[model samples]
Target chain A: MTRNVSICAMAQIKNQPAIWQHRFQGMLMECFESIMEQTQVTFDMDTGLRNVVTCSDDVFDARTISDAAVTDVVGAHFRGEEKVAQDGISALGYAMACILSGHDDLILVMGHCKESQSESRNMCTNLSFDPFYSRPLGLDYLNAAAFQARAYMEETGLTDAHLADIVVRSRQNGAHTRHARENEQVTAKEVMASPLVADPIRQMHHYPVTDWAVGFLLCCEERAHEFTDNPVRLTGFGSCMDSYFLGDRDLTAHFALKKACARAYTMAGITDPEKELDLVELNDACAYQLPLWAEGIGITGKARGPKWMEAGGMDKHHVNLSGGMLNGNPLMLGGLARAAYGFTQLQGTAGINQVTGLQRALAHGTTGAAGQHHAVLILEK
Target chain B: MTEKTTAGLVADIFATMESRVIPEGVDGITANYGYIITGPGGGQWTVCVADGRVTVVEDLVTPDVTTTCANDDWIAITLGKLDGMTAFSSGKLKVTGDMGLLVAAAGFFEKYQPPLAEITVADIFATMESRVNPDGVQGITANCGYRITGDNGGEWTVCVADGKVTVLAGIKDPDVTTTCADTDWIAITLGKLDGMTAFSSGKLKVTGNLDILSTAARFFKKYSPPSAGPEEAPEELIVLKQVLSIPQTFATGPVMGHFLNALKEKRILANQCPECQRLQIPPREVCAECVVRCKEFVQIGPEGIISTPDVAYYASPDPLTGETRETPYCSCHFLLDGCKDHETMWHELKASDIPRAERGVRVRPVWNDTLTGSVTDIKYFEIIDD
Candidate 1:
């Protein structure tokens, strides 16, 4: 049997708009020390912490080889260190792979993104596109999501009122989530009145730009007891990427998301996700993506998003109880944020957002424009 | 091109109803929208939307809401040339039954696309006289000639004499003549392409009495392309755009510092690994191959043979300056004297020597007049003539 990996401890600084006072290295060091304190882990070559997986993006940091900036803080000096330039959750997945492969027993996964360090978050994301066809059109994550939002709404009859309800509920749930960006509670009316940044995507509908740093202590399942009494077993992990071009995709189809979720489900031996899973955390960068990704995960029937919302499926399924990504988490760290929340809920330390008998949880993360790439992780206590 | 009758225009609007329906606006709704156009070529029609589908009929059916308007006004509203509320307040359009439904119906369709009527250079010249501004030519008298080439191209002259303008076919004793491609001329006249930019870029050429052409912009009002919809205002946001930069200090270790210091005195240096006996140009503290520290330094040549040459055509900005590099410069690796196989030092080959850049070509470093202890001390490598 393949070795099982468990996240023994999770640590993060608070999510904020800028954190202008601290550099990204300073932000990461806090989480690194926190993880070390929480787990009492060490860089023991024989059995403890041999490799580190770091998550960051060069475009956001404005420096090439960004992981080099945080190598010393994460204890990667003169040691094995790898970087996942995608989402932070992928760093966790990579650490899991290293432990499972028997290369190392314990691995440190650290991720940081200072979105405030850049001039415009959209301008940095705009570089993700090819220069010839997409960049000239000024297609960024926001406007590209606008195109998807308009198209998804057309297919599912998702109204503007439905989107407003999502924004209002996210802020309400954000009040209960620790380390979540502290945004003022907004009513549905306020959300509806908010001006559009991109048509069909009101400024209130999308997550705000945020700066954050997170670290996790992941170890082999057999050795996990040494780190913490409460360990969240990461049973399954899967990711999928769709076509690069926006025109090549069916905006409402949720093609990449479905594939990602299916792979995770099969790996975790989850036969019925809607019936088996107790909690879900979706990487909803925008409001419409909540229901769209819900359907993609097979937690709700396809094209039944509007009906599902009307029937209170969001509450029934315990989705995004940590306020989700719409409550403001930085890009490239949304999945890691979801995983952090999942770890909290599993540890029974989620405060007000915790469920009574939370046995299984699904946390998702996405990258690229209009959900072009997706990653799903299944965690169990 | 034949003019479209009002009835045909109304029919075309209904024909495109299915393609333009916003599903969210009509979700779970069953409604019949009727139109009774009154004027020459006026007719009645009905659009039925039910069960998330839409269909159009020639005759009016029992309708939840009926809009009554002249055929021309209906066409104008559909084309977005006239606002529906402005027509309604002016007594040109009347709505009967279900006023609430009419308000909801406003969002049911996307902006309609009238068939494209391409604007040509000939059309721009033909409308120039009608579009002339009286204030612009109040005291100006000049004859401007155009020699438009390429497809749909022709010659024409516009004579502006003291607030009165007349256009004549072909050049006639022109004070200044502008020559350009037909497509470029149309783009310039329609304001899609700036005339000054086109002239500077050689897309447009002006000869004789250059001062007269300076007033050409004031000669006419803005031209509107036929059948073009109004440009929608961009979405508003209080977005903050800032340029954030950090000054950084890089500490070059003793090994790299030694290599750079030698460049100032017109010398080249490479560190040799004790274990592998291999040289590292622009030396690193540790040898990657043997994983050992190197303490030995050897003097190499300021002249070398090009091992590999890569000509870069795409321009990427320099990290330090944030300015794009001039393109088509050759990035090359040179095997300096006393070095063998992949120990080649990387630098740029001179632009003038780019054509001669090839394997085994003998080249020498061209040093800057003021030598700083930097890699740029040797500006670039140029091919040496034996």
Candidate 2:
């Protein structure tokens, strides 16, 4: 059986176009203190709260060994800490892994990314591919995602209209949340009229370049009640990686996500995921990804996303109660916001965007082009 | 350089020293500066800096640093027309005494005025086009108009598109318009002025998207006016580009060394994973899947089928060299006979064969005329009929 890791408390900065007043240190200052106050958790050596995991990237931070640049705010108070170096989901996964291994109980996880710091995000993603072959082609996430969107849309008979609807709903949902980056509601017509970023992916389809800092306090079930009366338990999580080359994988289907969610399902003791999971928060980096990944993770049936959309959205199945990635979450915290929102849902603290009678929730994150690496987490009340 | 008043260049130095009442703690070590300028128009003078005060005398004194130079050269150095370090190093100015006190002498003075190097507004505006940073102006299309008010001042416009710049004498419907004085514009053009200081001082006024004006700063390298004076003349007016080459030899590890050695003999090499039975071409030290050492050097392919072909339309500049390659080049991976799935050899394809650069396309290795134990031994791969 997997160990129960409760997300006792969490805090995220108010998502802004650019936090020009403060740098990464200043943004982290309030985020760290806010989490401490929210959880009422203290870093006492006697309590055995020993490690910290920070999520950041060199390209976004524009620094070598980006995590070391913010050690004072993230790890100065801890005895042993390490950086995950991936998205927030990966760091949260590492913290949970530590707890499950019977080594550490309480772990501090912080994630921050300033999208404005990069000259071009697509160029940074281009560097992720192998230098010899893929790197020379100058393919960034937008172009690669365009190919995926076209292929996936063609295969599943999904159109640009379907994508436009997703953005409309995402922005609408974001308006009801407190810390959403894009809150103003946009109509499907407005989304469709937006300028094209790539062939199929429009400007509205893309996540706004945002500055965000989010911190979390994870305590084991043994002392979960000490932090909060109702703690949202992070029951299970699994991360899987597929081929690096885009040409090597079938972009139409989520092959890696299948493996990732399967491992999580086995650990969480979840069978018939469509009926078992109550709420779903997906790392919809683009608008098309919401419905596509929804079907990919078995939240909805294959080729049934369009039908679900036509039948008045995923209301029958609660998903992205706090908007999701289309609402301007930074690249590093793309998945972190999803997991943070999932915790709020499970804790019944998801104010206006809360789903009624919510018991279990699934939060998903993805990295690399066309979701090359996928991570899935099942959180329960 | 600002215009100054004095009877002559030699007397000018003495006059400035007379008024150069020193500040406290300036004269830590007392010294005398003696100047003996010899030329068609030459003279001598002595400057005594002691006890935080400086006094000048027409007669020479027992000095620390006895600075000697030609009258013309000394005048050039004092007027900022010639670089002081260049004059000293090139033996134009000779100093035969304590050189340490020469540096300390600068702090002993209140201020000394240098002669102005005459420059016109036309000369400053003429070089504006050449000073722009081509790379920085790339992909930007805008017209920046300038209006200079004063004698020798006129209207001008700079139209920039991508990396190309066109400067016109008259106005073009501009995005960002700037207004400044002729003196301020010339000073700014000659690097004698700071843009921010000029803006704050109300000498330079800019009206438009202030962002465009700020970006305009990046649109150009520091503008420097040409100096007609022999002392102030730069080595050249036009830029001369050169390739800085540093030869280096990198050590190839045992596995890679073996692979390159095999290439010299016109043979291919692969490393087989004992665990998965899968082979890696361009042989790796360890199998990526099995994570174990693979010492076996098995031959894989002289010919193979293209698995993934990338026909690049853009040429990303090599950051190290800043040189961009010609576009429409084909970089591909070949699925050799022994290797299946994604395990393939990464290499370039012949440009002529780019149309056929696709999956399932058969290709053969095209080796160089003379084989060397290097990765470049195989020039590229060419499409084969069968």
Candidate 3:
């Protein structure tokens, strides 16, 4: 077996609806300074950090080279830096590969996004589609998720009430999670009463537009102790992208997610993920995804998401105890936030949401419309 | 060796004739195709299609159409390595009898696969050293590794140093390594699936020194399956062109309001940064350099000198109006009279003045008849000769 890569420290600013007062660079500097304070890491070429990986999107940032805007603030001056344009969790995966390849031992991973910066998040997502086909029809993430939600609901018998329950529980859990976006607790009745943004998807079901910045210091397992007493090893990482066209995909089948999970599980030597994983952090950008992704990851049988939700499978699996993405993380940073929370719980630093004996955890992130791309990361203590 | 004999390839092509027939494509078509392959390993065969059913005979008999080509060219055409028309026009392939039957016969069958023996991963690696292009690898020194998985897959390294190339089994100390499924690897090598497309969509994974690995494409000449000619598709690609647009509105904020309001009165205003004392044209709310508020405003340019001029030949559609502006337009940055150094404002010069547009040329704004608080309040800047 090759050497493992350990996340020595992770830091993040509070996720908010909008951080209009400060620029995105200022938001990222807080996380950078916090990671520096926590690990006391430096920019030494031979002994310390040499390479930096950042995750952000060009369309969301409205800048061609978005990473260039934060290179100075992230301390990437005259150093090797690469940007992962997908969800930030891929940065963790990329950093892991760098360490395992013996190219660089220590890496700084940073990601930031302010969904509020754009006039409309839907407009930004709409541009992600091809100009000739999908974009002209105005197919954005929300409407695309509605199509998936309707399909999953019809197949699994998940109802409006079940979606309400998911939303209410997310906020109730988020109340205890610091740095989580401040969402008012709502009753299941209130969630049901919320107006539909798209058919079968209510306004309250989707993650709110949020601003966030997070950083993690990663080092090889051999030198893990040099950075911190508590180190969370990234045992495995895998990502899979499905077809670009929504019509080409069976929306609720979890085609990409299943392949991604299978690859990660094999890498971690996990035969039965349901039996081995201590906790699972799913990037549920919407309420339906909570159960849909749960089924996708094999925590429950196919078409059994509704029954599993009623039976409290979410709590039993200890999934999204940090309120998941539903309580609000920006689009690009959803998985990174999940990984950050998983890192905290494994370190026993999760204040009220902490669970005992967390030895292994799964963090999943998704990108593109209707979950076209999925990444799964396995973290072990 | 798995080099297929032309006779065997022709027999296999006829063997799969019935199954490869498309009922819709062959509907209402009655024809017989006679193939004459000459030279060593050559043979003759006839394909009969009637009432949507296909049958094959050992020899050419009562044929409505006949195609005559060399054994090598016949094999090349079947494997999609050489264009049928190219060979026909070049007299490498000769056709007689009903020519229309050949045109209708094109869509009668599905694409042909040359069988596993025709191409394999092992064959690709074994032939790498011999396929090296001397001119392509000149002065290049790098170690490129491959980890091809699946039933026929194995690891191999290509060491190129001092203009010489060597292929080694198993991965050595590599500067870069490319990992892909054996099937995808073969497709990429055969030009079936694009390598960049495979890499982007995650079908192919590459690690370590991407810059070094990029040169690997040039290190080896194109791979041609044994008994197959150069790789090029027979059909021309179909292209669909379209123009897409969406309506959008931008908020100009208070600082922009201060500047655009002055434009209505035939004047130009720029804001001064209190901290840096730098002026921002079109008036930004904050000074980017000082990162402080710029509250002081000054009237700068109704006229200015061009600092940079770019004459554009390509016409991209305007986002606001969804119209393509005429070509030979000059987009320039102007250093206004009151502004110094890099505080230049960007705008387009009049189309007619494009020939004379140059840096240090004096220009003045041409206002629209009815001014609205927008960037287009000034239609364009015209060159002020002398």
Docking class of 3: incorrect
lDDT of 2 by residue, B153-230 (tens): 899998988778889998889898889989888778767898889999999888876777777777777654343343
| Candidate lDDT values, in order | 0.87, 0.78, 0.87
Residue ranges of candidate 2 with Cα displaced over 4 Å: B1-386
Interface RMSD of 3: 6.3
Tens-digit per-residue lDDT, B100-206, candidate 1: 45655667888887666678888898889989999888899999999999988999999999899999999999999999999998888878899999999999999
Poorest lDDT segment (10 consecutive residues) of candidate 3 chain B: B243-252
What is the Å distance of residue A94 in model 2 from its true position? Answer: 1.1
Give candidate 2's iRMS in Å, 1 decimal.
18.9
How do the residues B1-386 of candidate 3 rate in per-residue lDDT, one tens digit apiece? 23443447656776787888888889998888898888766788899888888888879989987999987787788777787767887999998776546656767888887554458899999988888899889999988999999998999999999889999999999999999999999999988999899999999999999998777788888888875644664576655545333333333446677687788898889889898798888776555444345679999988999999998653544656645555557889999888889989999999899888878999999999998877899999998976
Of models 1 and 3, which has the larger TM-score?
3
Q: Identify the candidate with maximal DockQ.
A: 3
lDDT of candidate 3 over A161-254, digit per residue (tens): 9999999999988988889999999999999999999989999999988989999999999998988999999998989999999999999999
Clashing pairs in 1: none
